[model samples]
Target: MFRVLGALTGTGGPAKLDQEEQSEKILSQAHDFEVALQAMDYVLDDHPGKGLQLLEGSGAKPKNEEDQCVRVLARGVIEFLEATLGFEASVMKKAAATLSEAQQLSAKRRQQFQKMGLKTSSLYPPGTEYAVTFAEACLLHALLMLFSESMVESAKALFKLRKAYHMLREILNDINAAKKKKGSAMYAQGNNESFASFVSADSSTFKSVDIPYSLSTEEQQNKELMELAENVYNMRKKRLEGAHIGNSPAIERLRTDLGIQALKDLPKKKEAKKPVTLSKAEIDKDQATIDEFIHSGVNLCFGILQVVLSLIPPAIGAVLSVVGFHGSREEGLRLVWRSTKDRNIHGGIGLLGLLFYYDGPFQFTDVDFDVPATSDGLKKTSSNDLDNSTLLHPGKMLEDALLQARALFPNSALWLLQEARMLSSRGRLQEAVDLMDSIDVSGIEMKQVRALMIFDRAMTLVHLHEFERAAEDLLSLLDINEWSHALYTYFAGCCYLENYRMCQMGLMEYSRIDFFKERATTLIFDAPNMLSRKKFMSKNLPLDRFMLRKVEQFKKFQSQLQLQDPLDAIGVSPVHELTYFYNGYNRMTEDCLKLSHKLLTEYHNPTIDAKEPNQELVKNLLTSLTSRRLGKVQEGCDMLDKNVLPQIITLQPDGKVKYIKKTEDPWAYPTALYERALFTWKLKGLDGLEECKMWLTRAQDYADDYELSARIGMKIKAAIDRLEG
Candidate 1:
């Protein structure tokens, strides 16, 4: 345990000058990879073209096996980012290919190291030849990348995913075995001297030297990687198990196959086996280390556990009714409190997790989990109030973690950023802003971490409705963040529009607006309040000049306070517009269909907009209604039959149109039938009346238990009466 844990603290042997130079070279390569990762994040998050250029320019040819492994990983990540941002199948294919290369490279490295009889029990520094664990991480990451991007319906993808899971299970088992081995007296005693000797030896000489040691201390990173893997799986699983998408057959088959394969893969031994048992003391020590690792904030386990609990829902009582654990609020809170007791990374992370959990009020019921009806009988538990005397509040936890953890990781921007996030998550936006303002970023060395902190601050400001201030931050961020320029520019435009809205509503005082202007000047180290410039709104910014016409139109509407729907404001992104339309349609607002039509006609830029949550069906329905209002009876009938009615018609493999069940096409089926009934009444001859009644009857038949169906039925009856008269 000491061997494994000490590796995490960077305690290793002094290297020769030549070895140190090699280490330096490896560090430089690793640093390049890390920088590329950060740039990828920005590009994926913000969609800036410059980020892609930075990523492309940063690529360097590999000179060694280690460098080659890093190169593969970098290529995989870059391709993954491209696939995500572009949503292009070609990009996804490229990602799949790059990641496959990475996996092969990683596997080759692992085999090479294993053949050389490299000890896995002792701890090694990052740049050492013994750090084959990084290759394992690369392979795991590649597999996950493919799994995430690949279609679940594809049998080949499912097979690959199953293999990935199998690999992950094997890796974890090995790490656990290594942990157990290092814990034993034989491996633990006198291992430090062996490790020092192993590290000091030249790479060529070290492989041939038979070091008497257990596989060195790679267990800490193994545990961390396992946590990451679990977290990624759980997050993706949660999405699949959503009400709108439940119980994927592909995933289920993969899980079952993996389980069966695991059983089959176990070795059969003919020799008599002795049952070995541990003493109570030994058992306690093992449990202590496991517990410490589980709760360690350095890993993603805490986040994973929180997400798993959220998915379980409060009604379930215990998460899958597992032994020794309940899914109640008390159990969740208790788990959080246990981790918070630590003065290191875990404490800070636990506090942050607690804030999100507790911010939902008495119980953590914010996330919409697809909880089963059978869970109603389970015992309920309520979270303690924020002001409860016994419970530790989020505010106190953040304050403590900052003061306590500082002694260890004093220059950590993560801690400060998390603190700010906690405050923002709890709606203490001003306080969060002030805390961030106090952070002296000059002391932070990592440029990526510093940029991330600033980005977080900018987002927090946006949440606080300080759009002008947020815009300034975004503009500054855009200057440095080439990857996310488009995203930042888009947000900057949003901020301008929002600030304009505030001005129209008299929400922004002149002094506050002036204060924002002063901050913008100060960002470039200029004289504060010296430049009497134009008020920085979306319309005035020189950025994204192509959007000038749209901004100008929005400003005209803003001055007259004529933009009835903020969503309808011209300068707003199409993404926001779609969200507005979706919300309005769900609520069955009077102008929703018309609003959607206006958006579809005006600002639906195919080049820039994401193709999802399509509103064309709603627009067609509106057109059908409009034709009926204009007394174009035949046109209305034809529109309903052709455009509006087909939504509920699922085609069979044989090309026959099949009527979907109410459960399958919930909103579409009943609504389409009702529309069909209305349009049939407008058709020529008395047979039209009979056809109208038949369609209305079908609508009623499918919608018997639905409340909205009753309203549709009443309207259908009224139309039938008018036709019969």
Candidate 2:
């Protein structure tokens, strides 16, 4: 009878059949649901309405707590994506509801896990961690999506974002604890007596299996688990700590659109529940991680609020240093440094935030340089000094962080791109190009990454004065990605036009000009962004207001070049006479002057030499122009005579290089002479024409075969015809 009873129970084999069945059911349901949701993503790409079909059937229904959480999270994610893409308002409302449900479900599920002793210990079951982690990640990602989709900065949005922040912090704590335990266990096993005894007893085993090189199944599983945890940490870190416009910019913009105190009166934590207690060991182990997490979170939150506060009405960016967000440059740098020093994690984003803090907003074309004269003289300052006081060097810090990030994530193209950017910023053009070239783009499946690398390389090439190479790179980028069609087309045009200028100066072959010109003409006028009907900014192609102006510049430049074809073909003169010559010239003059002023104010370091030859050249050119315009012909002539161009080497058509004689720039000396001659002819009529003629002759000599000569020649002949006829 006892034997029969043992057989009925099967000892331990069939005794826990119910529990095994339950676990298997839960796992199967959750896995199937997740896989179905992933498949639905591709379907939703083309047929977004198909998502509603998923919610209609038991195919996506939850069989257990984990499945329930996954169902809620996936539904929320799908709806949010649809809503962001301009889906129905009803869908957006449903998305909000789903996300709220997911958040509550996640919290309740955590409570259930705690009750089951899953989080504190591993007593519940084998799949407990997966359920808990998946539910938690789902909650965090949903909140992130909610915040991303939210158009207004309501008290609710801030609360959700803050909650997500705390949740991520907790997740990171658990991951760190697991990592510590794994590390300790690995260390102990490696140094254990059994391992040492085995190695000593079997020399052949030692030869066959190197102790460190060979990993048991369990050890490999642990290694994979740790890697997965690290990846989770990085994912959460990016969303929470990234500088995406969604993260802080949207919140800030919401404040601006609403008001500064729009969400200020809201409760700090939306949830009023008390926090769970942990052991002293747990607290001690996670203290550093907690501190770092909170530090970064606060900076991110209030830093955004402060920026918004300072942006209203009069630009109060200066007041931020005084009374705004308590986060200083020092604190921000410290946060980035902490992340950057850690291994197998991301801090490149934090570094970017620090850069934005220091470098200020990207102004596209609004570069302003102002210098005020003091009692002693003009006080010297620079844009570098604008933000470098509290930091050793932001550039060096960025480089160090990028290096650490690359070491940690060797396959991450982002780190490589950032390192390349840092190199380009520091004027290491060739090194930047080489670094970008070293990236194996063939294996990179993300077209955006490939496009970015190519674009960055092209920009670096531009700096290196390799216009043809730069244009080629831009073409390659456009072929792969049309993120900012206008932006790329404009850049390509700029490259080609720059090469055309070099060709005009005999530095490049005339045949090269036609190739580049064809490219520029095809791309410049019909730049895509200029005609973009899309409503939203492209994730891959970011464009600013200044880009519109750049397009205009390209148009004006191309039009001017077209007008010069007759003169260019005949080799009669360098300067082409256009009907609207003065308009283009004046407009370009203002633009050039603005650029010069910015360079002088922001980039010039007076302390280096106290006397800049380039600055002197600009001053001389300005003085000559001013005197000529003010009817002081003699003074203008004197100024023009004193100035000369920087020595330049010209590459001749015969493949030989020659040093040209020091002379004035065509725009400077020839223009000065022409202006003076015109004024003289105006004052004294035909008798004054002799001095005018002489000046014209001198201008012609200086202009030689350059484009400037044509304009001067046209004016001289017109005046001479009036005087003689």
Candidate 3:
């Protein structure tokens, strides 16, 4: 009968099954599931090629639908990773095709099971597993489509994501319904037994497994068994004492041997174990195996979808909501936390997702922090307060999760990078850099992870004011990946420019100043041209576009002054202005902030007086930022309102129509507005909540069509959400 079922289900041929397993053992669908998990384990261990090889070897010619689905899904994952990391159009196309195939196969299997009225061995209804896999395929495919250059493809991706969202909701509903039914059945069964009988039965069913003696003397084995028996005897004696049962002679003797002084000293009664029949035990084992497989996959995928959708800027999120597509970051984080509880590949991915969110976007974009109460009033005394604040603090959780991941995959460099990021967030800049440097990416096949390590280390160095070394690190990334060459080049240029400023300020040797100046000019001039050559999905990235705009502004400034060097024509440090977007200034040391302030004030005063209104506006904007970070909140606010905001907006005589001022650097206006909002929130606490929102909303409105507008919008949304919450 088993052979015939195997043949009909296409799980395996009769001969193959006979050779693979004993006739008494039933074949399980979990074989392919386990294999897929092992493949992921191999990848996490820094053996990505071996992982792909194993998957291909097992899934090349799958005999069953489940095997085929796992195979195609794994293939799609590899392709998606390559495409995203390398930005290869051809690889992305292949990923799209593979995911589509997986989706169709899962759907077909689900329909076949439903039509045949088949019942799964587990508690879930027939085809439920296939339905979950189908939803996963849909979500992956939608995510891949988002990288497409075509507008139509983007629209289709949104609809597909919506479909997957609804499907996951339905699957969760089915799981809840099944759980309720099982609960009701269990409750009904418990009602049939008397309370005394139930308690006694549960106590009697607590049988311990006997360990077989191996390669040990009989005397030693006997000693171990005797120890185990004594422990069990004492446990039962304590239970009897807690239950207030009359102590028989046997119990009294056992308690006497255990050195019990008084009956009142006995521990409280433990909760009674649930009694299980042999048949029910076997059924539960099967149900639990399948439950882990299904629940982990569903929660991980759903959580990822929610988080990605929640990150969309409000401008785009509002449009998406009009079409019934919405997401909550809080809800997504909760679901991801659930998946992390399971010991599976999905759980690992969910853990990494949380780490990235907290260390990356959450740290970079979130603006809320607790202001220290000084004698005068509330004020932000140190930039370090941003990470130390109690609002949504994830430091403890991050540390615990990183420790767990390191224990599981000691050879993996990815977790080490996350550890370094945690260190950086806690203000240990040098330690973070050291930790990142110690990560050996020699065995890791994924170049993207390598690129990330370099980028992160360079950013930390920037915070440490090691500009020359940071520039070298950023330049090294050009050889690693093609995802964003323009951005890398632009970053290198900014670093060199910063080094030149240091030299001019007598912070470095004056001899290398000319070399740094020339290098900075060359890289900045070349950055724009690199963007035109390196296009992903036939479109420039948002950051790359921002870089191009800055380069254009620099060219115009240089031409107006007819200076041989572009840096000579600038009033404010472009690198410092650019760092504001990345929240780099928020991590600066007191000494670093002072040096930056001096660079802006001493060297830029002449340029500010060069009949350039935009130059003066931007100078004040950056100076205010530096001043605020150095514990001068009121001074920063006064400078912003007095010198920056008035220049950007002039009041009309009628007081009905506001005249807006035009400047070459339009991004500075909205960014200044955002800074003002932060100032209000710090000074007034909850009292100025409405005013803070007003400033943020105006910033968002004015951010339209400006450089880094999307970035500004995201920060504004995060701030507003914090206020409302």
Best by TM-score: 3
- Return the TM-score for each candidate structure: 0.38, 0.41, 0.76
Q: Per-residue lDDT of 401-498 in model 3, one digit per residue for the tens?
A: 55555545555667677777766666667877877766565555677667777878888887787888888988888887665688888888888987
lDDT of 2 by residue, 249-286 (tens): 11121111111132242233224333322212212211
Cα displacement (angstroms), candidate 2, residue 164, comes to 6.8
Please give, for residues 521-595, the per-residue lDDT of candidate 1 as tens digits: 233222112122221211122222223333444445445445444334333332233222112222222343343
Model 2: residues with Cα > 4 Å off, grouped in runs = 1-329, 344-398, 528-530, 533-725
Residue-level error in angstroms, candidate 3, position 590? 2.7
- Candidate 2: which pairs clash? 574-706, 574-707, 575-707, 575-708
Candidate 1 or 3, higher lDDT?
Answer: 3
Note the Cα lDDT for every prediction shown.
0.40, 0.40, 0.63
For all the candidates, what are their Cα RMSDs to the real structure?
A: 20.8, 22.7, 12.9
RMSD of 1: 20.8
Residue 494 C-alpha lDDT in model 1: 60
